[model samples]
Target chain A: MTSAFWAVYLREILIMKRRILRQSASMAVSPLLYVVAFGCALGAAVKVGDRSYLEFLIPGLAAMASMTQAFAIATEINVARFYFFAFEEFQAAPVSPFSYVLAETLAGVTKALYAVLIVLIIALLFGTRLNYGPAFWGALLLNSFSFAALAVALAMLVKSHADQSLLTAFVITPMAFLGGTFFPVDALPAWASAILRFLPLTHAADAARAGAFGLPPSPLPFIILACCSLVFFSLALSTVKKARN
Target chain B: MIKTESLKKSFGRTRALDSLDLEVPEGELFAFLGPNGAGKTTAIRILTGLSFKDSGKAFVAGVDIDKDPLKAKRLCGLATQNVNLDSELSVRENMDIHGRLFSMSAKERRERTRELLELVELWDRADSLVKSLSGGLKRRLMIARALSHGPRLLFLDEPTVGLDPAIRRRVWSLIKTVNQKGVTVLLTTHYIEEAEFLAGRVAFIHEGRIVREGTPGEIALEVGKWAADTFQDGVLKSSFFADKREATEFLAAAPGGGTLRKVNLEDAFIHLTGKRVL
Candidate 1:
């Protein structure tokens, strides 16, 4: 059983390697511009709560990269499986539905990992300082996997590429903006804050910023994100098991 | 060996596989001949455990598909109609991954990759990206990849649909070699010539049902004894025999100027399935 899991993990690594080879240039351009646009220009003009714009927007942009890359990973793979090759290889192989989904989710997280590392390095080059520690790394991983699972689950349910864009535009973008990525959730209305507290990214962004600034570690956000991950994972697994019929 | 008993599948309101019954004996090259939308793909997918059957049972290598689908799938290899390989990887990489999926050790996987690539005459091109290879080379790679784990039974759906004649012949020879080594092959093809060349026993499927099943010769005979005609001086010339039995009688009765040959699977398929091979 452990061997099977490793095989799935290695396959995911190989898949991500291929993705990086194919899209690294395009991916790098987006994050590079974000670093210049928000971290430099916008940082000079605005104050996010009490922190400088560069200090505040840096963690949020990093989290944004994590979410978009995670979602892209799942959506593109699902499209390739259904429309490009029709997933014949996976279907004929001994790998179960759960294993296939697991591989895809891992691949998605890897994409987010790639995007985060690139953006983080660029931020550091531009005079942005972060408190790097184990807690920060842990929080980053948590956010990547949570968003990947949710994205894959959503991909399985939708039927068209245009629909996927609509989902990202109307759904994921709103959450990123409102999930305390750009600012603290204390500024939100009471009802919105109550809902944001349940969101994985809200906790993810909070955990990330807290760790980056050398603040005391808190378990609430991790607990909430872990619960969200569990829900998303189960939903993805069941969607696949049901969709095959 | 493979067997399906009253296997049925439905997509929305359309009955893709309607109580289809199919069987392929051990060491035989069985062909599923049908037109587009004839449920040939649907039946093959269900039998290979790629799709679920709405009702009935499927077994591969004596393992019930529903009860032990993984076991059944492990016992068979499928080369689908579309070239479904990972284009990002090289030919060798694709086979290696398939080997890993079957849980082969690294050394064993490498060894098997060498053997299969050599068998397909693709060893020299093993490191080439799949997307870079020609259509014929890719097809050969798919066949080799299918055999990487030593599957007892193989499925090739429309194995050589759109290739030049020479390349098609190359694929045919490779399939024959695999079957010669005791692997049971279940192939689906729309081309009458392909089915005739590869299948020891052919089943004619139409409208989601097996309309006829027999050896190619038997099917030809059933369509009335087939006779070959030759052209001499731009004029058609031939001799007709009574049936499959009259081959000897006609040889003795008519001294050969040009010659007369027996009918082929193409004529039999047209007679039975009532569809062109296009």
Candidate 2:
């Protein structure tokens, strides 16, 4: 990578380091609450194919956390653009648009990985030890890459800081709930399941649950996620190039 | 060194730059003087490679900006009108990042950061969070950061817009010090006195065109040495004279009393374009 890419990435890392403790706490809260509210409420009495519902919920939460946290980088980008005006600093420098998008997307991936680590710790405390083989991580990484690239593209398209919240509400929030994170998509009607299959998060959650359950890995969801990552990354590059103009 | 020919840019139906032309020699403190929406910032943005022009050619330090923008950008440093520093980072971190973007070595970045911070007299505040500093300190840091890469050309766009008079004068001295060290400076400001005091040459831009360009003294001389101002029906009008005696006589015999003073660059702009820069 170029030094300019590292410079931009280093800046994001430095800011993250300064807020690590608070960020970790924020990342840990919702998963812990979900485990308490849903796991304590329905886990012992429910079973999906002979296992407790808590075991099923853990991987789904992990998938959801990866998507949400990776997409959270948009808030940081919006703050830099609207409040601090720091995006202009990059524009005035010798950094290329591709280098800029790559660095920011990787930074978003780093944040997602950090949030996933918190979910893993929460699962350990709940005594839910699911399989964590290479396939599980590969699916998770692709999922994070896809959402982070999407976040960078959407960030470039937002007009104001407040518009960022609208994107989260309209795009990300709906996907988080409907992408089979809370329940099995197969339980839904055939039409609903078919439509949900189009969402990248649906493939991510399915692949993650399959890996965590020690099932044989299927390549379809991974392929879908890889395609999503490529498309979103290309969109990020084009939007950033337009933003510079 | 910088040069542009027939530069044109439009936003929807509004023209931001219209056949703009400019030339700045190496090591000269050149200023673009214009009011708001007069294309000063737009021209600066295009020349620095931050924005593209519609139809034009621009060269920075002999490198075509459109052909090799990275090379052209590497030769210039820009301090925008707004305070665009990262408020969460320390003063030192901000400068360090800028140096790294220019591919400076760790050791080079360290040495340059110290040199620039000390030059702006902010070395003691290098570890302070940018948000914790006063506005004047933040402005000084912006200038210091722009010079971190040791660029051949420096662009300051309204560097003292929100500063108090005292702080503004301090920045003026810093700018002068930077230029004296052999770095060419291109400054854009609507403050007529700022251009008069700091720039070796001044260009008056109105509606995206250069109306007048010359040394401060040479431009002021075009409107004569003296000016007599008169107010009638809530409208202020000014007349220029080659001699103070002529101005005083006109002021004394005028229908209503008027103020007489030596002419400045603003007077020359008003005389040439019949518009107030402020």
Candidate 3:
């Protein structure tokens, strides 16, 4: 399991290693602009909690970045299946489907970590500092794992590159904007808040916010995240098995 | 090293393999000849564990495929019809990834990578990305990567489907060399010349069943030693002859023009199945 799963994960890292600069640049561009435009326009004046809006926005962006970067693996998986035939190679090899999915999920998590770094850099340039502790990282990892597993399940369901792009546009994009990234779910209308509370990203953002402020997050969000991650993980594994044979 | 019995597979209403049986002795170069859309690719998929057999048994190097797919897979190396190498990675990285999938040690990966790259004559291109390679070069690299783990059985599915004649012969020689090193090879090819030149035994499959199976010489003998083609009534018909002396006399005594040539595997296939091997 170690060798085979690492083989798949290491292959992605090896490829990413060559294009690390381009990847970092791409990740940096959006967060950089968001920080400058949003932070300058309204962030300095508004305060989400004990910190300025800019500092508050840092954790939100961290959550969003992890979700987005981790979910980005859907496109890569589509490319491997449709264009490069690399997924078929894995299927034909001696590696188990579970290891392959786990390796891909780890790759997605790795990307999320990189994106977190990029967002943190943007926060530093703005002189916005907050708690960078284990709790913060644990919440961040949970968010990435949940979303990356969802990405793998979605990749298996999608049949074409166009469908993959559609998912990014319709599902991921809407969730990034509406799932408590810009405003707290508690701040929404009572009826809207009821529905928003159920979104995984909403819990992710809330938990991550608590971590960034050096406060202990409640166990409920982590429990919900664990459940969602397990569901997505199982679905992805079964879908992958179905696709192979 | 490879055997399947009563193998059955289907895609919707389309039956890909219907009670198909195949056997290849250790170190034998076997070729499966069939037209497009036949069960050739499907059968290979099941044996290699890329796809499942509906309700039959397949054993690879004594490992039952459906029962122990990983063990079966570990015993064979499949270079599929399509070049499936990671185009973004360097040639050596592609080989390295495969070695790691088989759980080879670091030292073994290094040594095996060198050995395979040199064997396929791609050692110089080891650091180059796979996307940078020409079609012929990519084909060779895939073969090298397929052989990276040194499995007892090698499955080559149309290894030279689109290459030019010169490159095809180069690949053919490479395959022959690998087989000579005691690797059992189960290959499929559209080129009758390829099978005739490389295979120790050949099987012709059509509509998911083996229509004929035998040595190249033995199969070709079904259409006799010589063949005469006559075009009349806007249609071409072929006649086989066992005696060359009689065939010569038969062609010379013809009142109308016709062509006579040596009976080959393609002729035998056409005569038996009413379909050309190509």
Best by TM-score: 2
* Residue B278, model 1: Cα distance from true site in angstroms: 3.5
Cα lDDT tens digits, model 1, A1-245, are 33344555665566567766557776667667766776677658878766787888677777777877887865665666666563567667787777867777787788887888887887788888888677777787788888888887887787777788899998788887787776678778888788888767778888888888889979998887777778888888877666554
Better of 2 and 3 by lDDT: 2
| Steric overlap count per candidate | 0, 0, 0
Q: Candidate 2, B272: how far from true, in Å?
A: 2.0
Candidate 3 chain B weakest ten by summed lDDT:
B248-257
lDDT (Cα, 0-100) at B233 in candidate 1: 75
Judge candidate 3 at residue B133 and give its lDDT.
Answer: 93
Candidate 3 per-residue lDDT over residues B93-173, each given as its tens digit: 999899999999989999999998898999999999999999899989888888889899999999998999999999999
Q: What is the interface RMSD of candidate 2, in Å?
A: 1.0
TM-score rank order: 2, 3, 1
Candidate 3 chain A TM-score vs. reference chain A: 0.97
Model with the higher lDDT, candidate 1 or 3: 3
Docking class of 1: acceptable
Model 1 steric clash pairs: none
Superior candidate under TM-score, 1 versus 2: 2
Best by lDDT: 2
